[model samples]
Target: MNERNSASNNGLTSLSLIGDAAEVGISPSVQQARLPFTVRVVADDEALARALAVRQKAYMRHVPDFASTMHIPEKYDREEGGLVLLAEAKLTGSPVGTMRIQTNRFRPLAIEQSIDLPSWLSGRMVGATRLAVEAGGPGRMVKAALFKAFYLYCVNQGIEWMVIAARTPLDRQYAALLFRDVFGVGEFIPLAHAANIPHRIMAFEVGTAERRWREAGHPLHEFMVATHHPDIDLSAAPSLAWPGTSVDLQIPADPADINSGAGNAVRRQPACTL
Candidate 1:
């Protein structure tokens, strides 16, 4: 894959689905939508700590043992080509959700430690991990928003595929988003990345997401494609610097105004509430 230097003049990447909607058979006009919370890339030590707090709390509900180790930032959280996203309540500024995205641009994906990817799965890939969200109705929205943020990040970085290793039941949620199993149909393999817990490896093609979602009459089709979410901000995100280089990720000093409704004419939707 060639290096993708598609950052705008102000140094922030734009979502490809939003930029090339017509090509994917989606409406160019996006409806402006708002959530009770804001999703953004974790840029400072305090932000990361808040993210870890939510992560640990979310995990404590299921995997108490693993949750114990999650209070502190993981090594991958600060690695090159990897970034953590945090969702915070607009009213309280408390973390509600978080996810870590790791790309194969700099090193083998964390998933690669367990199984060798098929040759057909080659090319620019990103793996979503450590996905954790608070419980309840609002948490559901936060989880969905975080997934959208992950998809947007992949599209912005010119990623070919979005990959994840999910355990049972939780994997079903990804299936609803149209991710397909990479290994076998309904096959769960032990993943070292998840503390040897069995998980189904799934992948979604980033380049084809818009087309696929539209074709399937997906429930989130409008939300994912035609909705302008100013709350899901990635302007402070570190640029996908040179490929194959061990350069550290750094947020731009003056990131682009991604929330600016430039080409997108919008209709305001009611703000979401918990």
Candidate 2:
């Protein structure tokens, strides 16, 4: 995680550094200046908690003990030294989606294995977790945007791989990113470290990830993951860098939103492995 933070900070000091695709692309037309929204990394604990609250509420709506907070900052963010990206309504400053990317050391799977992996499998890669978006996600655009920030980091870090432990079971979604399932495995999440509740082991190779995204056909989101999870395959289902990964999402009503007078955005499919 420290590596990620250091690399990102270093990019600021050295402006000549090559970063994300967005930076390379030609500027959008002036009329396009109207903000669709704004994205930023959570530099403070409060913002982190607010982002976690959104996801926690979603998890607990079904499995009561499943989740109640974004506990990474309290327990792991500092020690692990990863990064947290937040997307908010540019107009209201309401955090809408979030994803956490950290140095490979934060993955529970590797830690539980107690077996060290080669630099290619671990050091050359990072781990992405706790990805969540608000109800009306615009086919998950906000989540995709936050992911892009991580990709930019990878480009600067020169990292070559990515690993993820999913709880939501989003295989088809991930597969679209060329994240084929790598065969080997490692996993364990003691209660002492339970944040999103249950965590699973998953991984992906950069080439595979790039291929998946290139193939998934969601160009904007594809581009986002490419920069955020660059080591990830943009065109493959699951991934080859480590193991298969996916996410499960179900719709639930949030009293907070209801009180503000908005209904649940949409009724979603069950938390399937899909």
Candidate 3:
């Protein structure tokens, strides 16, 4: 972790997404390639497709049989859920890196196989999955931006807690973001680790998180409040009176912004109620 922070990163920057390269009047692409880059929500299907395509490229470059990565179709255009994000070059309008968000906040456990634990039986607040960022090319910054977008979405949705299977490299960073290892507090059920990364668990109130960002050393704190998600409370409750695999779990609440507004897009909200 220390090496990642101290290691000098070199790469060609493309900040075309924000058109702020010349204005920052500082930190040209040449000097800083790893990031501190702006985050943008992708709306156009064409653009979203392009972002996913770029992610495929990066994934293929590293992950074996990269072509197998399923291409995500635009859900927003269909009046659905899910979000896509992009990082563009300020000077060139070129796409640099991207990430995505596919939430199912208040959905019932039976509706989706991924979420089997019932609310009352569950421990955390929200469950987040499909957090894929383009590898390399300032990967950490790109990842942080993706997380920021998701954070704002959760806040807008009135979410009080968040859950995830965080990559090991991000253990400390996620901890800083207020995500605790699974079932560490209160009566909780732990998710078994799968893939190479452990399913890192986290929970935090939006207002509290905002305070932490304010009182901390993070520079991208503003990103935490930029996006807007409608109030999405789970009204969570345990599915069964006690733990049992045979019984189906249940949480009577609205599912999250799974396929909303065509991938991810810039959201201007009346300041995050942080």
Candidate 4:
């Protein structure tokens, strides 16, 4: 009778442990809920237009002078070594947010025009620009989803560093995301490529992003590294650089839209990942 009781207690203990784990939301299936929107590569001119609209709308609220000319897609949108990501509402198909990513595979990064990068950051770099999202709850979520896509793209392309020039207030959020200043901390550099705006240049190490966040106990650590976000789609993304080297060089015509909004104007508070 005691042997049977011990077996029964063992079974109960196993069931109780599983129940406890479930309560803590340990399963990926439980944590991996769907996002209200989906972020994907801008496939064609039409999709690019939608992304541009989102950019203009979000920027106009803060920087009307720059946003006025953003009605159409920028030259980088069609560039060989660059791509634009768009987050669209799954229910309404409206563009919720957008971010433009360009690499230095063929030419130097846009920020290079302003300041020279150190030897460590000279190669295999991806820069993000024109990041904007609608002003609301959906906008916050869209920004997080877009960043996940950015991180995944960098990983797939073997990008060493992710760089960006952010304006005031936005720079603080970037700091929270584990982005360190490439130059002097808290010093804003005037980026000629970004309309001579005094913006802070920040970079995130792609290879060490997961480990750094985990070690630091970052708030978005789980959302970034642990959770599997299916809403971020990179299927149509152009390959910027491979694991070991840069791809074949392709120089497009100098369409002359390079010096656009690097320091995009958005008034939204930095939410989940910013």
Candidate 5:
């Protein structure tokens, strides 16, 4: 951890996915030849397809029924205020991980349909959905990198809270990351946007991530904060532009009727809200 912080703070160019390249006996030139992985917003149809493929494959392993619909991208993928993050192996250009992050800019979050968010959770909140990763070679490491990308995006966009509806067992991972239950502990709510699947609603305060981790001596504190991942790119582009305007979404109060658009392009409101 100290080494990562030193390298990052000193602006070293030999950073690796999980450790320094030099420590792994790889020459800088060889290390630079291939990117370990890349994290970026889905910008084109091809990229979206790759993301969908990974999402489907990963979800199928755990939730086959829900995974069926994931073959095609959803409406929220292109929402101006929401974007999909795809991680690909540079060597093959194949997606290894994917996550959909949607901010509550114009409408309430998807989980809101199942349970009302407290006022404290209102405003500048971002929700991560469809988080999936290939189950090989440093899968945990890949997940960490993807999370770092998510954290950076939230910071850049001034997102306050990072929220998710995690399923059983998977919710334990978020708990290890210090995410708190948004409603009740062990209470699983069926999410409308998730094929009526039950998930535990959880949230992490974005702005307090650093402080909380440091104070708690969190296991991921160093990897998340001290380490710098240049591979995770969030540069602005045509498709990557954030939708600054709010879009009117007809949110339903009942989880059964919550039909939050997934792959569809957001119908932009005249004035951007977020």
Candidate 6:
């Protein structure tokens, strides 16, 4: 894998530097928040494989049948308008969480494959899918951090709506974040992309998220807007990076060369056994 040097270097800034804080009107001192794991865009095949491994493991616990098909990368993972985020433990350099964000830039969102989005929702939409985190207390933090990354990515990309298809209890989680249903309230529709499973389609307005959270006294509001997380790096992702700049993606020629350290975007941490 051939590494893109510029992407790796430019990706190190904290989330506080990515967007204008004055727009929200409640900028605190913006304290830096550090975690035991680093979340970043999967820039190479090796990172993608690690993300897939964690994805399959997380799915197997709840959806073993569906997990069977997740061992390999899906077509959506490689699509031009999409980028996969991978969270790796700082200790072992092992993937702890993963999420894929797909924009309706060149094509329709994967969720659209299952149902048509209402005409009322328009302009620069993104769907977050394949969210999975390692099990345990740390996993909870990883899930939240991944979401913060998702939200930050949307902000940087000028995305209007952040959409998702959640099932059962997961739908409740999104609700807690103030995400509203696209259809009728609590309505679950069968999604073709999700193995025909019934899921409630929900959407979040990216621009108004901070204001809504602050107004509703949302618990995660401080963590989402007031704190800065340097570990959640979206600058490596061409589609999500700083506005106006573009970089051509280069995928490794051989999938078997997983051990090749070339083109890796994962930040090196202190070595430790898993």
lDDT of each: 0.71, 0.44, 0.42, 0.67, 0.65, 0.71
Q: Residue 83 in model 6: shift from native, Å?
A: 0.4
TM-score head-to-head 5 vs 6, winner: 6
Residue-by-residue lDDT tens digits, candidate 4, 1-274: 2211222111111221121111211222333435667888898889999999999999999889978999876778888788999989889999999999999878888889999887767657889999898886556557766776787667666667898999887787678778999889888998887788899989998777777866775555545555445666676776553434433111112211011101111111111221
Per-residue accuracy of model 3 over 166-254 as CA lDDT, tens digit each: 44444555665655554454223334422232344444554366556546633433333322222211122222212222322222122
Give a tens-digit lDDT track for model 5, residues 138-169.
45556766776677666555566898999876
Which model, 1 or 5, shows the larger TM-score? Answer: 1
TM-score to true structure, per model: 0.79, 0.56, 0.51, 0.77, 0.74, 0.77
The deviation in Å at residue 254 for candidate 2 is 42
How many steric overlaps does candidate 1 have? 0
Q: How well is each residue in 1-274 modelled by candidate 6, as lDDT tens digits?
A: 1211111121222232222211221223334545678888999999999999999999999999999989898999999889999999999998999999899878888888878899978777899999998886677778877887787666555567899998777788788788999999999999887889999999998777877877886556655766556667766766433233342212223321111212122211212333
lDDT of 5 at 141: 55
**Model 3 lDDT-worst window of ten:** 19-28
Could you tell which candidate, 2 or 5, scores higher by lDDT? 5
Best by TM-score: 1
Using lDDT as the measure, which candidate wins?
1
For model 2, state the Cα shift of residue 235 in Å.
28
Candidate 2 per-residue C-alpha lDDT over 1-274 given as tens digits, one digit per residue, 9 for 90 to 100: 2222222211111111112222221121111111245666666778778778766655555556646443435444444446666667766777776676766533544333433444446545677766776764241656545555555444333345676555434544454444544434324333223443444445565434444434554334223331222222212111122222232111124312211111211222222243
In model 1, what is the error at residue 17, expressed in angstroms?
20
Superposed by TM-score, candidate 4 places the C-alpha of residue 34 at a distance from the truth, in angstroms, of 0.6
Task: Order the candidates by lDDT, highest first.
Answer: 1, 6, 4, 5, 2, 3
**Candidate 5 minimal-lDDT segment of 10 residues:** 256-265
Which runs in model 6 stand beyond 4 Å of their true positions? 1-30, 240-274
